[model samples]
Target: MASVYHINKGINRPIVFKGFVAQYIAYLAVGLVLLLIGFAALYVSGLSLFIVLPIILGLGAGLLLVVQRLSKRFGQHGLSKYLARRKVPAFLRFSSRRLFTSLSRGGIIQ
Candidate 1:
């Protein structure tokens, strides 16, 4: 008798939902949660719904647009790469060659 094993086709793939890939989905969720919290706070503070609703709605729309644009532009790992690249210095400053000159051909300097 021969047996067949089933393999998951999605192995090692980034999770995608409605055009959101990987971390973007989490970003959107967190943004929405923050918007909800802001709405509730504003409402509890006695602000008119007419005032609060449009503000929250506009923020939510902006958040969605920004997150979607980032997801599309940066894909999965590009955003982290971009952020790390930003942290790198444009040029290293070496005052002198003494650090390099101290190194021996066969061994490191004490």
Candidate 2:
């Protein structure tokens, strides 16, 4: 008798669906959920189906397009890296040299 083992080829890879990778899937899901809630709220508020439907549908479509574009542009981790880059200052400023002086003495100023 001979036995064979199956290997998982996708080990250590990001989850991808319909060309969306990793967190982009979650972003699309959350956007859809919010659109659903908006539809429900508008319907309950006595808005006409004709009005509510088109508005929500348009928003949902826009959300899909935007998310897809972002995923394509940013890959898996580039979005996060971009946001982090935005948080970094262009140039750090220090009014005093006390910080360096203390470091040379082997102690922090604060």
Against the true structure, whose TM-score is highest?
Answer: 2
lDDT of 1: 0.95
What is every candidate's alpha-carbon RMSD to the true fold? 2.0, 1.7
What lDDT would each prediction earn against the true structure? 0.95, 0.97
lDDT: which candidate is best? Answer: 2
lDDT of 2 at 71: 97
Q: Clashes per prediction?
A: 0, 0
Residue pairs in clash, model 1: none
Q: Following a full C-alpha superposition, what root-mean-square deviation does model 1 have from the true structure?
A: 2.0
Residue 5, candidate 2: C-alpha displacement in angstroms: 1.9
Over 4 Å off, model 2: 1-3
Worst 10 residues of 2 by lDDT: 101-110
